[model samples]
Target: MSLRFAEEIILLALDDQSGKLRPLPDRALELAVAGGLLMELAFANRIDTDQKQLTILDRSPTGDTVLDSVLQTLPEGDTSTIRQAISRVAADAPDFKDKILKSLVEKGILNREEHRFFFVLKERRYPMVDDREEKEVISRIRDVVIDGAIPDPKDVVLICLMNACDLSSAVFSDDELEQHSDRINQVARMDFIGQALAKAIAEIQEAILETISYMGM
Candidate 1:
């Protein structure tokens, strides 16, 4: 079984050989991952959202540690809008990225190794233990953007994450991005459950950036 959402976001943001996160606009990755987390929770039927707010549908555990941890923290009642939920989760989840990496390692998708950059700076690296999953993800995106197949809703969500994190360049070449830019934009805005999850994500991403700017991230 695949771990969706944030795990895929981390997978995209990570350095394939080093396991370190790539330099992005600081906090953008976390914010995007938070949006992914909320979407996954919504899909799991543990939460639901509208243009206005997100509400808990079930409090039962999802049996995944990272998901459960964030689920535990979402405020009760319907006061939290999707953007608010995204911001809160992003703010609270300082370790969810590490947890996602550990989950991938446990799944044998990656191998954890210790290395030093300067003979003094020790760091943990996660090289590929299984490259197939990575390839499958890339293939799905290509199928939508390049082949013009109608995207799976999950693929649309992944594209939304990539946009939120400024990660299109990580996966697509300059020419491909240029040529398929319109299709990518169209797919990322696809609808979910009669609401636009892509719009929700894009709105949340902007809200996060505004907060980050005001707070000096």
Candidate 2:
């Protein structure tokens, strides 16, 4: 099962794809948490019609350039109905709560305890981590993508080599994949990233020395 909180944490950092390696968006992550809470509340039938309507607009738009572009491309709809829905939700906070509560209860993922409620899955619950910690992880991933400091060069070379030779072997195991990934992050920083990638490709089966083939190629 997916960890709802973990998904929320990575939303914002996914926005900038300019980097060779992209990071998740922080705001998107927060929006996901909020959305999960909303989902929890809705399943509990604590949401009102109005609250649900408002929530649609509040959703995180990160990693959604295509969606956003599509939305903008859509022709305008009638505004009065949308406005009326907003007004109705604003008028009844209790109804909103009821709707959310009912929805959550219906989903069987939330349970009421006295007045308060709790999510069923432990993974859904998370304490907020500070920006510093988040930034550190992001930075490390970026460094790996840009610098080519992957812990194991052999695995990276093998993948590229396989591609060059048009050979289909057993897939890289998860651990080997992660090592190649680490190198990808580091390689993102290299001026000769393209060349390095080429070298990786050239290192596949060859009559000449592998390293020399990569160099000459």
Consecutive 10-residue window with the lowest summed lDDT within model 2: 19-28
**TM-score of each predicted structure versus truth:** 0.85, 0.19
Candidate number of the best lDDT = 1
Instruction: Score candidate 1 by TM-score against the native.
Output: 0.85
- Candidate 2, residue 184: lDDT: 47
lDDT per residue as tens, model 2, 98-207: 34333433344333333223844422221222334334433443344445445233233222322222221122345645656545433432322222323322322132
Off by over 4 Å in 2: 1-84, 115-217
Which residue ranges in model 1 land beyond 4 Å of their true spot? Answer: 116-121, 192-217
